[model samples]
Target: MSLDALTFRPATLADTDAVVALVESAYRGDSGRRGWTTESDLLDGRRTGADEIHAVLAKPQNMILLAELDDGSGPRLLACAHIAIEDGAGYFGMFSVDPGLQNGGIGKRVLAQAERVVREQWQTPTMRMTVINVREELIQYYVRRGYLRTGRFKPFPYGDARFGLPKRDDLSFEVLEKSL
Candidate 1:
């Protein structure tokens, strides 16, 4: 779909199911394989669940930003990302775009809106996100969008079913930050 037909809005509890499905399609299992953003090779099982989405919605200063497209057939969820202000910086996570729409500039648009919201609404000077350290290509994609690698790392939540099952022992997260 064209970018002009897209709409950005804060996700509500009613959108939990669609958001979960969109995230799963972009990151886990066979369905995610259709997209370049799939993490299927590095992880297994579900990427996210309805309960987690519900928790995000119920929290203060947190929101799941959604991108919807109306192509005359009716509005359909296309992409989403979770954003929250914490420790004086905006945190971005749970990002996903429709597999069929990957590399078509939809993700970039969603990211721009997320950054705008953090900057304008939260009045934050910086935005931060963590990417799996092994995802060099994904990191490079963010680099092109002005995010810088901080060389800081965090251990992956091994044994945490909520995050996903790690396929390798070396899995870890590298923090990336950008000045807004």
Candidate 2:
């Protein structure tokens, strides 16, 4: 829970599988149900794929920021979030924290670091993200972090199983923004 013990760094291609696993574990399947952030009830299947991560890593301005802790062994990935410049603002997405570590302060620290990375490294003044509209609790978490709901909606990729297999017909994403 102490930020001092967490190491923040940009992930490399070598981290693709780890990143994918962390993401999937946090949001999909039975493993994800261990965390409050799990979308497993609303969707099934993978949250993200290796190919998608590879595409993101292939870009110069984009990065997957990793939060790691040594925990007596070598550092292990605890959380990750994807950041990129989109339409001149920081686009934050693919955020995931270990299911066992949720509700601790680790996610907040990682998010603050992500905002710093975007504001300082990318010189972006704002950060944006899309959250499923039905996830009111999750949206409130971001709201507490200073993000505002824009009332804009993006259709969930219903046909795209790569994103997830929708459990219902009402799934959609709402935009959230915070000025950095």
Candidate 3:
């Protein structure tokens, strides 16, 4: 969908299935191959499930921001962001845009909205996320969004495919942060 035909809103429990599907399409499957954010090579399983989405909503300190198409055909989940409050800052993650709709302004606008929600609603001063270090393109996207590389690295949890199956053995995450 076009950016002009979209809207943003806080996701509710009812949106779990759609959101999970959108995210999977954006990252872990054949559809994801059409966009730059595809984790297809690195992972070959479902990106997320109902239980996880429901758990995010269950967290008092977390929220998932969703983007919806506004064609009145009803809200079609397009992009999403996961944010959690901790140590007085909002930790951002689990973001993905529908593969076919990437390279448009949809993901950017959704991220801007996520930042706004973190600051205005949670009163957080900073937003942070961990990106797999080898994802240079995605890292640059975050940099362009005003986040700075912190040079902090964390081991990629391999045995636990909860994140995704690794495409390379050297995978790990680097922390990036931005003040709100």
Flag the better candidate by TM-score, 1 or 3.
1
- Residues 75-165 of candidate 3: C-alpha lDDT, one tens digit per residue: 6787899988977788988898888888888888888888888899888889999998888999999999899999899998887766777
Error of 2 at 22 (Å): 0.8
Model 3 clash tally, residue pairs = 0
TM-score of each: 0.98, 0.97, 0.94
Per-residue C-alpha lDDT of model 2 across residues 85-164, encoded as one tens digit per residue: 99889999999999999998999998999999999988999999999999999999999999999999999999888889
TM-score of 1: 0.98
lDDT of each: 0.94, 0.94, 0.86
Q: List the residue pairs that clash in candidate 3.
A: none
* Candidate 2 residue spans exceeding 4 A from truth: none
The local distance difference test score of model 3 is: 0.86
